[model samples]
Every structure is written in structure tokens, then in C-alpha cells.
Target: MDGIIVRRVIPSDNSCLFNAVGYVMDHDKNKAPELRQVIAATVASDPVKYSEAFLGKPNEEYFSWIQDSEKWGVVLTWLLLFYSEGAIELSILADYYGREIAAYDIQTTRCDLYGQEKKYSERVMLIYDGLHYDALAMSPFEGAPEEFDQTIFAVRKDRTIGPAEGLAHNFVKEQQRKRSYTDTANFTLRCGVCQIGVIGQKEAVEHAQATGHANFQEYR
Candidate 1:
């Protein structure tokens, strides 16, 4: 990998994880909800395979909540292994927060189960800073920074670069510096109708209902 670059998705949405996965997989962000449904249904339909201990919730309830847009989490890496009958490599940015955490890797290979064997190739990198998720990409760069191409950032699971441990450390440090002067007293939510700023999710939703504003954006 030479002169790698990371392309960031739009921020401040509860769907960051799904959107990040979609961006890396070359799918529409809107498809995330559907993918979530498929994962949930797959788990629900076969509770014996995806045991309660693994799912961490009752099959039906977990299935319903996972499909909700506001629910922002995933057990897809495991689910994908079962769905595709293949392998998956998940690389996580461990020290994204101001903490000393060990960077780790999870490799899940297809196993002989139900006498079903299929072949597929998929690998994904997810960047988590304890709160948000983002995708990463690296490619050769020869053009000016301003004129750098975006298509080059598409997902390429088969290709990988360095561990980039230094990059993770430096990014956390920069975030910490920015936080020192940032006032994060309350989560801000902006109404879509009148564009009024409200604090807290409950209050924001109440204000929206009262003012006939159904849309809102959250800023943390």
C-alpha cells in the first residue's frame, strides 16, 4: 500500500455502523436496514445454531430491535460466517479512544456444519472509537491532495496494508487535544422543521411532536 487514504462517511447518525459496512461493501447506505433484517431473521429462524448465549437476547425481541433504525450495533461478522459458509477477517482499530487497548484481529473460517459448504470471499475493517464506526481504505496516491480521486477508495477486502499502529495512536492524540477545548455538555439535536436546537433525545422528540417536526439530527 502506498500513500493510503481513509474516506470518512457522513457523521452524527445512529446508522454509522451499517453505513460504514455498506460503504465498504459497495452498497447503498439505505440497504443497511435490510441487511440488518436479514441477519436478524437468519438468527431468529435458527435459534439452536445461534444460541441465546451467542445472540445475547431472546431471538424474537433481538430480531425486532435489531431492525430498528435507532439501534446501532452489529453481530454481523459472526452471522456472515453462517450465511455465506465462508471466512471473514475483522480488523478493529483498538486504541481509537484515549485509552491503552490492545489492537486485535478476529479470523473466522467456514466449518463443516449441516453438511453445507459454500465458497465466498469477504473482509472488512471497522474503525470504532467507543461510540462511532467508520470504514478505512488505502491505495496508491500520485495526484495532488485536492485533486485526489475518490473512486480509488472503494472496498478491496483482498488487499491490506500495514498494521498502522502509529496512525491509530496519533489519531487518538489529536482527538484528545480537540476534546480539551470542546464543550460536550449536552447532546444537541436539531429539528428539521424549524431548525431549532434541542437538548436530549426525549426532549427533542417531544418538541418535534408538538411543533409538527418529525425530522431531527443528533450532535454529540
Candidate 2:
């Protein structure tokens, strides 16, 4: 397909960000643990670079927290349950791979480029719909299998950013028109365990604290 870009949806298993990065960088979807370890090791190696003020926690604490993958059933369940990857993880992985990582935000239709000033020669892309992350790739044709996807593009050739931004805007706008995202702030949710209703993440968290219900299904 001529300039066809596609959003490859990664599983929303709390490791979606890592999985998307893995897919773009190595064409692998299961490198979350390995990537998490990389972030932890990088942070540990340079405490001064990744300080308490920068990480919003002590360097050691941030590293430890990033590496732990325990789910909601554990004691630190609340933190783990709501943990979503942001700038910190992106910067670490971008430097580790020596490639610029561009995250196209659907809500704002803006590109957040990590390693933007590093003069990386290659670039990879991801689509962010507020809560989840998905890889952006150039497919050989429309509806092509992901096995045939081309993710990494040459920055020197100008093969990545401009084209990706245009296609991403189209994709993001279509998704917006379809209402394919959760507002998180105002969306209604029903507790999957007890079928009780709650509004927004705040209410859901409060309900979880009072009733020990962790499973929730978003609804209209």
C-alpha cells in the first residue's frame, strides 16, 4: 500500500507501553519484563541523572517500583493497578535503543518525541489514546498482517516523522469520531465483581477502597 500507516494495538495488560515499544523497536510483543529491567538498571546506574526530584521519588525507590510487576492482588496493588507509563520510561527506553520514540497523542493530536535532541538516526512510533499505547507502523498494504509491518524508519531519509504525523492525525481523528476512547475522568463504570455503578476513576478507587472491588468495566 502507498504510504499506508496502521496502528497495531497492543494488549492493555498494564504493560501496553512496554509492549508497544518492544514491537516498534524489535518487532516483539512480549518484551515488557526485559524493558522494565532495562529501565530499572539504567536508573540504578545513574542516580544523579535520574534523581529524586526528577523521578518524583528516591532513585532507588523509583527503580524498584518500575521493575516490580505485581498485580492488583498484592499489597501495593493500588499503585501497580493504576501505574501507566509516561515520560520517564520513554526517555530511558529511547536512550537505551538509541532511537527517537514518537508518541502521537489521540486526545491532543500532538506528537511527544523522546530523545528529540539526541540526533538519533532512526525513529519508531506509538499511538497513545490517553490510557493505552499502540505501535504505529507502515504496512505494505491495507489490512496487511503485522508480520509485514515496517516500524523503524530512517531519520536521515526523512521517512518517519512527517508522514507519520499526517497519517496519525487521520487515524486519531477517525478514532475520535467513533468515540473509541475512555474519558477516564468522566466515564461511567460498573464494578465487574459486584455490579455496582461508579463515575470516573476517583469514584472507582474510592469504591474499591471501601469494598475491595478491583474489577471494573467501563460503560456508557
Top-scoring candidate (TM-score): 2
Error of 2 at 102 (Å): 0.7
Tens digits of lDDT, candidate 2, 1-220: 2468888989877788889999999999999999999989999999999888777568988778777664211122222334333777888899999999988777666678899789898889898776678999989788889899989877865535566557766887887777766576677878878999888767877888788766676678
Candidate 2 differs from the real structure by a C-alpha RMSD in angstroms, to one decimal, of: 4.6
In lDDT terms, which candidate is top? 2
**In model 1, which range of ten residues has the least summed lDDT?**
89-98
Q: Write one digit per residue (lDDT tens) for candidate 1, span 10-111.
A: 354556665665554553455567556656666677788666555544667767866777655222212222332111111111111111112111121111
For each candidate in the order shown, give its overall lDDT on alpha carbons.
Answer: 0.42, 0.77
The local distance difference test score of model 2 is 0.77
Which segments of candidate 1 are over 4 A away from where they belong?
A: 73-122, 139-220
Clashes of each: 0, 1
